[model samples]
Target: MRWRAGVVAALAVAVLLGACGGGEEPVAATASRTPKPLPISTPTSIQQRCFVPVEGGLTTFTGPEGSTMPGAVLGEGADVAVFLHQTSAAGFCGWATYADWVASKDVKAVLVDLCGWGRSACKGGFAADAEAQVRLLVDWAREHGARRVTVVGASMGGAIALGVGQRAGADALVDLSGPAVWQGVPTAGEAAKETTVPLLLAVAPGDRGMDPPALRAAVKAAPAKHKRFVSTRGSHGWDMLNDGALTEPKWSPLAHDVLAWVKGEYRAG
Candidate 1:
């Protein structure tokens, strides 16, 4: 969940050494640098980076068809938030930062690799088998002491979350840039109509080829009494949860809104 501090230290050494080898007069290495160095904890575009799995936190589950699914769990509590990854090959690692953030709030964070992605390369790939496996996990969580379960997903995983949330009877749902229709599974719009739990539907305008207006409208008209439609300006799916969430290009309120909803503070906006 943290960036490597050695990278910043190495950069600082390079800058200081460069000052010592100056042209006209060798500048003192002890002199102050022009621009301040970035902090060690500064967040980058993590979703685009390759993530090594966290050491020793890995767990496995057996699907109905006997396939093994690997995942990691962070934090522990009666309330659980299950994260499904977007279509990216990075899989559940894409949700690592956000999951850690959720764990800090005392909620159990469940990060799964879905079926074909990450370490769970099953026979059927990302087909109906993946959704079935997620549904099984949801039930598994409930049986294992989760009082309330909220399913959250992005892109392709988002669409699967909607369907799984409905069929699995999750207490709440968060869908980020999920397509209305993905492959041959159930339509997200239809799943949205059937979702009775509190829902948060977030999408960036002009995200890839997604129709934000239609997606927003569908969530707006969903039967869930507590539902919100957020319009953000950022790259699609997992990229929306960035360090510059309050700044331009990432939109001012996207990350905050999602967290608020995650914490059960569902403001009607």
Candidate 2:
């Protein structure tokens, strides 16, 4: 009993000393509380770090698999126009100006960065990842009360859009300089054959790595019911967004055609 009392008194003193910061924490205790090195950045953490609320219409959304996808939402119309970027690595930034124009036309213009491009992250092949991620945004727009959703993509993004628009149930699709085949897949031409939504396929004459005529033919043969193939004069991809001279109207011949065509599609739908 006497030894038990002595042990209890010693333990109480030790506790008090520890509480008052008079005792050093054991090595094991200190190591256990070291905060686990803040686990590697997963999709959620990546979103928190890179995807923040931005000014001037910029926003972030979660991908299908939880990646943080950055984009911009311009205007507040129930009809949504989701713009997917090309493979140039410029991401959503490349589509900003054109998207602004689309927004001004009384539509909700959304410029999106595909997975593994821009600030977005994903763990899969580029084509597949892009398709899934973009679909997430389309579904998001519909869930948020969009009456219609149109996916417009350029180059590689355009190829992916050929398939994504149909799969995501988008009201329409615009493929700018998209190839009939991409990344060893018949992403555009074959997908076009199955497209049930309204479609617009535009290409410049000099754009390489794409068979514009074949693509046009494929689109025309598709059962989309509403489709158009606009032939323009320009370089490729984003270059097709502007006229070479950068004149007053500024928009490329293709851009003008796309705008007019899309406007009609929106009105018809």
Please give the distance, in angstroms, between residue 86's alpha carbon in candidate 2 and its true position after superposition. Answer: 0.7
Candidate 2 C-alpha lDDT tens digits along 91-194: 67666667667777887888777776887665445435555676788888888888878888888878878866678677888888888787733566678778
Q: Which stretches of candidate 2 lie over 4 Å from their true place?
A: 1-55, 123-127, 244-249, 264-269
Candidate 1's TM-score reads 0.73
Residue-wise C-alpha lDDT for candidate 1, range 1-269, written one tens digit per residue: 13568888878887887777743244444454457778765223233233432332667776655577677777877778888898757667777776766676878888877776876755554335545767777887798789888888899888887766767767888888888777745676777778788889888887746678778877866899899888877677777877533222232366667766766778997
Give every collision pair in model 2.
none
Candidate 1 segments exceeding 4 Å error = 1-56, 123-127, 244-252
Alpha-carbon local distance difference test for all models? 0.73, 0.71
- For residue 265, what is the lDDT in candidate 2? 49
Model 2 per-residue lDDT at 221:
80
lDDT at residue 115 of model 2 (Cα atoms): 71
